[model samples]
Target: MRANEGRESAIRAYTRYETLTGHVWRCACRARMLESEQRTGLVVYVDVSNRLQPPLPSGYFGNAAIGVTATSCAGDVVSKPVGYAASIVRRAIDMVTDEYVWSYIEHLKNQEDLSKFQDVVACGNPNIAVASWMRLPMYGIDFGWGKEVFAGPGSMSIDGDSVILSSSTGDGSLIVAICLEAIHMDSFKKHFYGGII
Candidate 1:
């Protein structure tokens, strides 16, 4: 879309995740009618599948993602152009590296039991977690029958959990799926589309 809009030359060439995450966070904040100064956050999962120096072997497969949080006041999220939030998201992401990943693992090791660990991301009302699977092998997943026609998370079981998936046709379109209270969906939809610039 940015290419079509001829905006690649813009100072900030936003990635798809940054674009959608910022837009969604703003719309969600407005939909919830959060107070102007209330702190709002977005937790985005970053894949470290290949961040290590030696890297995991080519066939390795497991949970290799970590979440990074970006925060700002609700007023900033709602009042600024999407690029403002995108910059925050980009900064958070840019901080991650092989060194950070190693340190994060050591931090995780300190937890007595991994099952009870929570990473300080506020879960329900004001924070959102976005997991992008756009670059994963979602469409190529096949079984005995055939390649699946569509592949996506069965549901967003919690409030503010979102997923970004590539369209099955791989036409460069994306599927953004998020869950919010029924009462807020209408307002959020309006803001999400209307604020597109």
Candidate 2:
């Protein structure tokens, strides 16, 4: 696993050698299932009850494996593969993806010969106003609990691993709510409650 900015990161890429025939759906599902199994298995195998951050990208691939030699249920323990299966899988995926990416880059660089250009606009950002608040009234409907005490807009966007939520009152009073994935949700909840977790 590679550490980025003092945080561990694992990037996993899986390639199935079987679908050269171009059956897209099966191939895609297989890859997705493989990734899901890896993620779920490793999370429990490591007993990382309190750990967070999606297992870093480098260690992600170490999770691929065939057969259910073991089982993990909630907090229950079960047999696990020998050695760092998750880590090993992760490395293999990264190596393969890196090779592919580099090969493609090299091929493009040789053909397009655009390496001389310093500033290239990949795509111009189209100005789009995201109105998530328009969906706010829908939330109360989901819970089947009738309308909320107040219907207002929540201003927030996900920034990397963090989520910034803007809370506004009917009177236009505003507050910021910072959130992170599962583990950090509690902290954000506390902040959201503002003294009532």
Candidate 3:
């Protein structure tokens, strides 16, 4: 049992390593796209949940997710190492404290024209949005029968977006689903899987 526990711990650490590396790789891909597509600043939004150190009840089902934006110039993101982009992502996420959450709430409440907030982020202009569902019990979800054999997001157009889904094997691995324009998909795939930079 102790050995199994140790193995699981190591696998979890490796999963985290992969996730960070994947994120940086995605950032680099976006930067390359910006240069190819003649776009400007890169605005990356990462979904951050406040449930880690919840200020509310543990079982509260209300939405506790916030989108944290990390902005950088195209040249900076492309020229820097993966660790640099990872650091920017880490800092953006770490800034979401309880106080920051409350402030965001207040800011939303004070909005005069909430319709402006409803506008979806444009896919152009070097934007990337990433949402991770890795920790969710996706495979365990069952309507009445036993655990599901497989589960994942339905097919959708994800141009300029990415989703991290839990692997179906119950192992500490993640399935990153990315969507890109047909023109840029080849380059993105090269950087993503090949670690070209």
Candidate 4:
């Protein structure tokens, strides 16, 4: 497949994985919650900069991105097929307009406690955050010597967070770095790669 084709496939797969994982986490939370308590929904945060039209300036160095979240109940997400989850993700992403971006900035500006603006995972919520670094020129960076053989995130111990990075071979492939507790890693692995092969 061409690079774009591979990239699209990777995006779809990653989104599906994220949706499934978010559902799993939500279900886990429900299991732990009191019987009278309401089930906390799952929120999946997807990076929305690439979906923006008339993209930001090429050399713009500031944070030019916002996250769009797809939320659903544990039963709805875990019981439904992957296509259902994918559609939720697609709609959430499609809702990120230029106006929405500006509104998000205003919302941030209005916040009284910046410290409370924790990421989905850090907020003690049943949520997941996914960031893609697939198109970055990881292998093309050469200070003085030749290109580096391998490139990936500096650390990978953040639970409920996943980062998608380009393969080091410069091939049209991706490497998804996921961090989960030891007990849940096996089940996550099963759901992550079960039908993909």
Per-residue CA lDDT of model 1 for 1-197, tens digit only, reads: 23124445656687888888888888899999999999988998887878777787888868888888989999998887777777788888888889999999998888888876664545567988888888878776668779786688986768888888888876898888889888889998898777765
Clashes of each: 0, 12, 0, 0
lDDT of 4: 0.56
lDDT of 1: 0.82
- For candidate 2, write residues 38-110 as lDDT tens digits: 3222111121212322333544533321111121221111122212232332333333333444464476668
Candidate 4, residues 1-197, lDDT tens digits: the string is 11122234645443534444443443343333313333333344444455456666677675555666666665555555655555666677668777787788799899998787674344233555566676667787887878776678888776556666777776676677766556666666565555343
Name the regions of candidate 3 deviating beyond 4 angstroms: 1-32, 36-54, 144-150
Deviation in angstroms for 160 in model 1? 0.5
Relative to the true structure, candidate 2 reaches a TM of 0.17
For residue 123, what is the lDDT in candidate 3? 48
Alpha carbon lDDT of each predicted model: 0.82, 0.26, 0.58, 0.56
Model 4 misplaced stretches (Cα beyond 4 Å): 1-55, 118-125
lDDT of 4 at 128: 53
Which scores higher on TM-score, 1 or 4? 1
Backbone clash total for model 4 is 0
TM-score of each: 0.86, 0.17, 0.73, 0.68
Per-residue CA lDDT of candidate 3, range 1-197, in tens? 01122334443223343335335445545635556433332233433354344556656675568776766666556665555555556667667777777788899999998998786674443666666777777776679988776677677474656667778876786777766667776667666655532
Q: For model 3, name the residue pairs that clash.
A: none
